[model samples]
Every structure is written in structure tokens, then in C-alpha cells.
Target: LPKTSNREAQKIVLRIKRKCRETESEEVAVSIGIGVATKTEPEQSIDQVLKEADNEMYQNKLSESRSTKSKIVQSLLNTLTAKSNETKEHAVRMTKLAFDFGEKLGLSNSQQHRLSLLATLHDIGKTTIPEEILKKPGKLTDKEWEIIKDHPERGYKIASSSQEFAVVADDIYAHHERWDGSGYPGKLKGENIPYLARIISIIDAYDVMTHDRPYKNAISKEEALAEIEKCAGSQFDPELAEKFIKMMSA
Candidate 1:
């Protein structure tokens, strides 16, 4: 959702396109399926997620059926590549911001890289959710909300299933956990939470609040900053948030 109230919802999709010399040096035709939300802000209420997911799936089938190589795939790849430009210049911008925050906090290069990765693909779990649930606009039934909440677990499963990302699967799975130990999946607190995940979460919240999305209006930078400041020691890591805010102000 581009902009929404506590009750608003919107479906988001991702697409992957193939590029191989086998089909074309410039492009390759590859079969594609609907993209998933893989990442969502834990701050979003359960009601909003339920409403948005139902609609996302419908569009997924529509876009996928365009071909065994559906526009949906094209769309997802386009989203991955293009939507960033259209949305907030690029997820890269936020990624760099994450790294900068890492630097300010005195994290190592490898740790910064990990924070960048987490910032980039944080929503990857949304891929496991059915597009039907993702696109729905009306209030979701309790059963549907259950499916939406399962994305972190499902995404963790997907990442763990893949040999490549096993290193960071745990971080991705628990990025939503709060500093105060009020978060989901584990309720871990303070330094008990993984540092990279905590960093990603802080930046993720900053991005969500500062930008306009399908389900919610963009808050002013001042408002966004205040929100983060207020959440320090509650939803955010106090020391980390301090470093990040200073970086942003610079």
C-alpha cells in the first residue's frame, strides 16, 4: 500500500527476469512466478497486512498468466530494478544509508555489508505469502492474518533452504525483533539481538516512516525523526538510533 491508515492495505509484488546468452545476450526468456513481500515492517498492524496481501495475489496471477514468462516476472524484475527508482530513487539509497549508519556506529566493513544486505532484501519473506492474500483491500479475517504473520517463518525457511543465504537467514528471520524485547519470533532484547538485524531494523523503520507507500502517507522527516527518537530504547536501539540519526542529519 502506498499510503494507508491503521486499517489500510495494499499488495506489493516482486518479479525476476532472466538474462542469459542462451536466449539473448541482452535478455533471456525465463519462466517466472509471482513475487512475495519477503519484508514487512513489524510496526504495521496485523489488520493492515491482512487487507493488503489478499489483493497482491490476484494481481500476481494476472501478471504471471501473461505468459509462462509472465509480465509478473517482468514486473518483479522491473520492480527490483525500476521501482526503486520510481519509489525513493532506489533501495540502494536506503542500503547506503544502512551502511553509513553502520559506519557511524563503528561496525566493521563485513558487518556493514551484512547490514546493507539485510536492508536491501529485508522484505523477502513476503514472497512466501500467497498473492491472493497480499492484494486484498478489505479487512482480513483472522485466518488470513495468521497466514500473513507466518511470512517471517516461511521466509526463514526459504532462506535456510537455499544454500547461498544460510549465513544470514537467522538475521533476516528476526529483523523484526525490538530492542526492548517486545518483538516477534523471539522477543530478544538489547545486545541479545543480532547487531546487523538491529541495525537493519532501525534503518528500515526510518525508511518506512519517511517514505510514501501504497498503504500510508509519508511523514515529514522531522516527524519520522521524532518517531525514531521516541522509540529509542523501546522499539529502537538507543545507541544505534543515536548514531543513525546523526548520520541522517549530516
Candidate 2:
């Protein structure tokens, strides 16, 4: 106990981490944050040593949380990409537009980060949809349309399953909600929809309109912007849609 080196302490921590992971349950993965402090001075009080270790442990916890969120998000994206390359590319494009719009609208850094995640992962539920239905060349039947509309709920459940993704779960669920309360899963109207979800709705509609999909050909940027303007206060939030139109028109 008197001569333990930092290197040896780190080795011990790694061993513990590995063991924790190895013992993880199939349904829930195990993660740990560890902190180690060495007594470099004979005069150091036990209280001081404990305090230092506690501080280190807190910092490690924050770092571990961020790392875990990143890994889970990446895994979801990979799974989504495997299901549909078009959707993945759409997410990439949407993320850039989302950040730019967030900056223009003066959203806080944390809000912007949340918006970005929703932008990319909002359609994660589509991974559960049948491929033929998702890529149908023509209009869907009423039953198929209902099936498609169920994606938001599906996405919400997937996001809610992980602590890291739970932050955006509500937004993912409400992204399709209409300003007029006509949108799916919940007929949440006006300000009842989550703010980030509102932001996503406007941007997502714009992106989808301007891009070619199996069901529809791409429209011009001008048309897309106009459609956004027309849908304001109905399909999209009037204030947010106005801002989006101006941002794209600029």
C-alpha cells in the first residue's frame, strides 16, 4: 500500500473494467468508471486523499457517459444505414442543415446538439419496416400507410430503450406531429409538440421534398422552400417554418 505506482493502479482498474464487461447480462451491457489516487506524501490526510479520488471518479463518470452515448448512437446509425443507404444519406444532409438552422435561430449549444441527434436518428424506426413497403414505387395502400405511420412509435421505443438515447426519444416520437394536430402517434398540436421535434419537422419536410425518393422525384429547391412556406401553421410550425424558409432562401 505504501509504494503503489500509477501504472500498476491503472492496470488494476483495467482488469476490473474487463471483468465487469465480461459479466454483463445479455439484455443490459455493463459499464464502469474508476478513479485512482496515490499517496505521494506521508503527511497527506486520508480525507484529502478520498476527496481527490472522489473528484476523479466524478470526472471519469462524465467521460464514460459521453463515450457510451457515442457508441450507442453509432451502432444505431450503422443499423439504420444497413437497412437503407438513402435514409442514412438523408440524415447526413439533414444534420448539416439542422446545425445551420439552429445557429441562425440562436438555439443553445445543448439544444443544437439535441437537434442534431434528432435530425440523424429520427427515422431509426424505419429499420423495422418492411423493405418493399419502405421503397414502394407507387402510393401505399391504406393499410401500408398505417404501417408506415407507426414508425415514430417504433423509433420512440428504440430510443427509450437506452439511457443515452432517451434524451431524444420524445422528439423522435413527435417529429411527425402536425401543427394542426393531424399528425400521427399523437395528435399533439401547436406548442404541445417538443421544440426540438418542431425544428426537425420543418427541416425534415424540406429535405425530403428536395431529394429523390422511391415514391417521388426531387423537386427544385425553390419549390421545396415554397412548399414549406405554404405548409406553415398547418403541417409545420409557422414561426419555425418561416425561419426555415428565410434561411434556405438566403
Candidate 3:
């Protein structure tokens, strides 16, 4: 409420702490720290320090991965999917790549539109994963892979429950399925895996390959595209692969 700036001509700050629920029925201490200090001030004064403590007084803040005002529908999920903002951009780029790939494949505008939405939120299920598992810096064990693989399904349920996004729910579930029936959560290969989902899968793999993740360093675009080409018949749909490569080349 009181500022050191008024007294000492300082910079401004607003520290906020509030009791928050990290999850349903899970109450956690949420702290927000704000401060105002003079550029010439030598140190924090008792009053300024105590003023910073009022964050707990309001009890009305929520922790968001992004700013409070976000036009992006999936920003919340994006934050939970990976450790840093870099990961968020990577996901966004992949969504763009997926939509562009779909466009190149002659998908209808509406299909591309919905595909982009689904792609953006594909990893929403990652929210349910523990932070340790999501932020692991080494190769995931087989058991971990098993847990991670369940995300497509979990994402489906979470998105479907939103009611507003029910259509994309199916896409979330099918994104992980490969054309050759080698995918997970009921592998409906080829056209059976929703077209948009298939579109996203190709681009998703490409982006994931090119970006550094918890267990891998980023490779060059050329090298990542090469891997896509190499895995065409196995990891990705050959048709989608060709289209995506052509899109990237363009």
C-alpha cells in the first residue's frame, strides 16, 4: 500500500501471495512477491519488506504459465507440457507446421482449422503428469514411456469434458496413432486415424525431432527432416510425410 518511491523515490513492485488450490481439493500456499524500491536505495527497509508481505492478504491470484490475458486457447496446457517458455513456442510452431502441412495435403479449411486447434492442445494431458516426470533430464525408462504414452488418451478425456472443445477430443486421442497401425491407444492406422490427427502427427514428430527436449538436444531442420523422411513408412504416414516435407521445403 505504501511505496518507498513516495518516501525515497524508488522503483515499483507488487508482491502477491494467496492461498490457492493447485489441484481440486488440494490447497497449497501461493505466494506473490511485489516490491517498490528507490534506484538509489541501499537496501530493503523494514516497511518496504513488510509491504511486500501483503501478497497473502488478498488471497486472489492464480498461477498461470502465461500472462493473465491470453488469446491462445492452449497456453495453460502448453505451460504444463514442458519446462520452459521455449517449449511453449515449440508446441505453437508445431501446431503451425501441422496446419500448414494439412493445407499442403489439400485438407479443407475447416479441417485445417480444427487440426491446428487439436495440435495446439495435443499434450494437454501432460498436466496430469508429475513435474519430476515432465522435467526429467534423462532417457525415460520403459515404464515412464508407458505413462507418457497414455497422455493422448488422457488429453482426449480432459478436452472432451470441456464441452466447448468436444470435437477436438477425438483428434487428441488419435494424434499418436501411426499410419501403419504401430501407434497407441487403439491404433487405427491410415485414414482411420482422423485426417487432422494424422496431419498433426507428422508435423509433431518433425518439431519434436528438431527441438531440444528433456532428453535430447535439438538437431538441425535439415537433419530432422531427414529423420522424417527415414521414418516415413514406420513412424509417420508416407503421404503425410511427403506433404509435410514439401510444405517445409516451400
Candidate 4:
């Protein structure tokens, strides 16, 4: 193949990748490697070219596997968002806010990364709830409330089931735990709760308060912030909530 043909092949591969991103199941990761044997290189056998291309493709696949796993998880989150009242945009906003809070708190790069994932998938377990129960506009009965509260544990199970998400499993499980040991499946208090989970709790609540839900109208941002501040000591880590508020204000 000529140099022009090689360029054309590369262009075609890139086009395929671009198309994958635009596709509805855009989370798919595509890898392509092309090797050309030129007539000018008579000493190079077709087998050698094929072997080189295969090796490059293998390396590409290895590198892309991590990205592929991330995309698949994101796709799952998208499915959850679509099924529930929560929109994909809400997840995106929360991820950004969580990452910002993590950075402001001087968390490590890896911790911030985990926080981003936790923020997106914190409510993923809600998928297990019946659609009618999830979308019910009226107050929940004790049994329905109990079922809804089980989502954290269910989310933990889902996250832990996959190696890619296992890092954030505990965070997802404890996201609903309270600072005063009054909340959720574990009733964890203070530093007993995962720090990332604590951060997520504050941000998640704020997002919920400020966003419209099937059962309620959206509140003002000021009102939402006030509610978060009011719940700081009881529902959220006070110090982290303070820092989060400061970050948002900034």
C-alpha cells in the first residue's frame, strides 16, 4: 500500500470511532490498526506485515479495555437515568459538583476519580424498585419506604459485582448514612462513614432539592443551600458541608 492509502486507512478508522461516539449506544469502544506492505519493501513478507499489525491491534485492545469498561458502566448509568425520573444531565451535573468538592477538599487524584463515579451511580440501585413505586407521586407507605431505602445496599451489590466499579462499592453503600448515626441501612456516624460517601450525600441532597421531581416542584438554589446548611450536623458531615457550600459560593 502507498503512503496515501495508509493515510486513507487511518482516516477510515478514525471515522469509525467518531461514528461509534455518535451512535445511541455510544459507549462502545472501537480500536483499529492498519499495517501496509509496500512493493518497495520486497524483503518484508506479507506474514511480517500481518504479524506487526496484529501485535499493534493487540496492544490497542489492551489499552482500550479500561476505556471500554468505563463506557459500559456509563451506559448502565444512562439506562438507569432513562428508567428513573433522574435525567442523564443530573448525573453529569452531580459528577462535576462531586469532583469539584473532592478537589476543594484536597482529595487525591484517585479519590476524586472514585467520587465522580460514586456521584453518577449513587442512585443506581433504585433501578430495582418497581416503576410504579419509584414514580409514585403520593407519600410512600412504610413498606414502600423500606424498599426504597434498600437501594444503597442494592447499589453496593451492583457496584461490587463488577471489578471496574468495586473501588466505589463501599462509597455507594454508605452514601445515605448520616453524620449523626440516624440515617440509612448502616446508621454509620461521623468518620465511620466513607469520606467520599459523606461528600456525595451533601451534593446529592442539594441536587435533589434544587431539581424538580415527579412529586414536587424545584426549589430555589438559595432554598436548597439553606436546607443543606440546616442538615449539616445531622444529615451531612459538617466540615465537608461547609467546604462544599464555600466551593459552591465561590
Candidate 3 per-residue C-alpha lDDT over 81-123 given as tens digits, one digit per residue, 9 for 90 to 100: 4455655676789877766666667778888778877777788
Better of 1 and 4 by lDDT: 4
Candidate no. 2 TM-score? 0.73
Candidate 3 has an lDDT of: 0.69
> What would you estimate as the lDDT of candidate 4?
0.80
lDDT of 1: 0.64
For candidate 4, the 10 contiguous residues with the lowest summed lDDT are 31-40
Q: How many backbone clashes does candidate 4 have?
A: 0
Predicted candidate 1 versus true structure: per-residue lDDT over 64-121, tens digit per residue:
4444333332333344343233232435667888767777778887777777766655
Better of 2 and 4 by lDDT: 2
- Top model number, TM-score: 2
In terms of lDDT, which candidate is stronger, 1 or 3?
3
Poorest stretch of ten by lDDT in candidate 1: 7-16
Candidate 1's C-alpha runs over 4 A off are 1-90, 132-145
What are the clashing pairs of model 4? none
RMSD in angstroms between candidate 4 and the native structure over all alpha carbons? 6.5
As for candidate 2, its clashing pairs are none
Question: Residue 223's C-alpha lDDT in candidate 3?
Answer: 89
List TM-scores for all candidates, in order. 0.61, 0.73, 0.67, 0.70
Kindly give the number of clashing pairs for every candidate: 42, 0, 11, 0
Which TM-score value belongs to model 3?
0.67
State candidate 4's TM-score: 0.70
